[model samples]
Target: MDSSSPAQGAARSADLAALDVRITGCRACPRLVAWREEVAATKRAAFADQTYWGRPVPGFGPPDAPLLVVGLAPAAHGGNRTGRMFTGDRSGDVLYAALHDIGLASRGTSVRADDGLELYGVRVTSPVHCAPPANKPTPGERDTCRPWLVRELGLLRPTLRAVVVLGAFGWQAALPALTEAGWAVPRPRPAFAHGARVTLVRRPEPDAPGTGPASAELFGCFHVSQRNTFTGRLTPAMLRQVLATAAESAGLPTRSPWTS
Candidate 1:
């Protein structure tokens, strides 16, 4: 291994850590702030003894990860409760199980922030950091939270090679963020569909460095929400298929779902 690799990795980790801190501290959207706080204070009956994260949830995973999983926003009772994206939620249960089958996740369940879950060459995040009411964030709130995504994209450019966006909302939100982060999104922006795929190239700059990946593949998959999963619109095998493809495109090794 090259001596510079460790140093570079450390620097990237530090940058992302700083970003997460800033993300958790954000209160840019008044309505989201109020709603998340109210939900946190209400204390769900099952979790009354536990403390709530209550603040904006930051993206979870390693800084130099090669794959990105994008979702709509934090769940009011899930991430807003555990301080971790996707944790303590049914959606997270399905997604993580699929990821584990694809060899991108360390475990099949993500129940809490301290659950020892780990992701391999993949990072999970959402367009909006704060949980929204009725599981919907206003378009205005989405726009307000975009800069964080843009910054995260920029930070991950060095190693990022693929992105799997769950749901239309995240797809729409990610395009502008990716563009702002240096990728040249095609004109007539592509529509979102389960199993859809697109390749995005980095916009050329006068002094563009050649040390990092110049392009990233983007895949679309249905969100792992109860509505989709329960209705069989997105099955475990189907979700794993998309994630496996994205993982391979990101240059990460994946295990076949059919294997033990």
Candidate 2:
């Protein structure tokens, strides 16, 4: 749905809230939670008593969105601290600005959820629901979290048009999962880079009763991490180009969210 419409936005917000409620209290990985709690406690004072979300971070976007943006995981002081994907951090600053410029974001500000930020035809989520130590999740932990992503993709079914992986890690994590679920693999299996677009084609018809591919497009690009952006690895122009390709694949205009 487009931002020019109001009713569609309201419906999508409710859908996102439903997903958020389901995992808001999750403690599926005790080790991760314990570590998260410890970090939160240690930083609570330094953070001026800002309480941690300390729970599973949920994906946010339109339920039937054509584009899905996959990120690595929650940052300890970002999503983990603020309870919203890509919020309260430098990484989010880069991401939200690009999204806003691309028309996927309604509000340019992503410092906090209360800022009234909204995603239009795109949805943003991470492979790991919980924040990990030093932002690094173990292989086992990532595997354990795969089911949640599977369920989310299924729920957003039928309308999914393109998938944008925001980093090599996210690409590595999600590509196999999408392949296993029957989506086509990108020709040459795109390596993560700024403005790189790998076209994944899903058949107009269902798999031939047994062995066929699911219908979907897959895109990849370098993440808008602090390291990437601050170091000039991912430039603003590069991010815009990548998003423009993503929107084109999803059959949307690319007027850019930043200009408005």
Q: Which candidate has the highest TM-score of all?
A: 1
lDDT of 2: 0.73
Shift in Å, residue 191, candidate 1? 0.3
Deviation in Å, model 2, residue 177 alpha carbon? 1.8
Task: Give all TM-scores, in the order shown.
Answer: 0.93, 0.83
Candidate achieving the largest lDDT: 1
Off by over 4 Å in 1: 1-14, 205-208
Q: Write one digit per residue (lDDT tens) for candidate 1, span 1-260.
A: 11122223323344788778778877778898899999999978999999999998989999999999999999988999999999999999999999998788999999999999999899999999999999999898898788778888888988999999999999999999999988988889999999999999987655657846889999999999999999999988889889999898888998884742
TM-score of candidate 2 relative to the true fold: 0.83
Quote the lDDT for 14 in model 2: 37
Query: What tens digits encode model 2's per-residue C-alpha lDDT throughout 1-260?
Result: 32222223323443456545655555667678888777677765557678777667889877878888899998888887888899988888888888888777886668776778989888899878888987788887777666556556655556777788888878878876666444667656667765556656553435344332245667778888888898998888787777778877787766853442
RMSD of each: 6.1, 7.5
* Model 2, position 115: C-alpha lDDT score: 79
Clashes of each: 0, 7
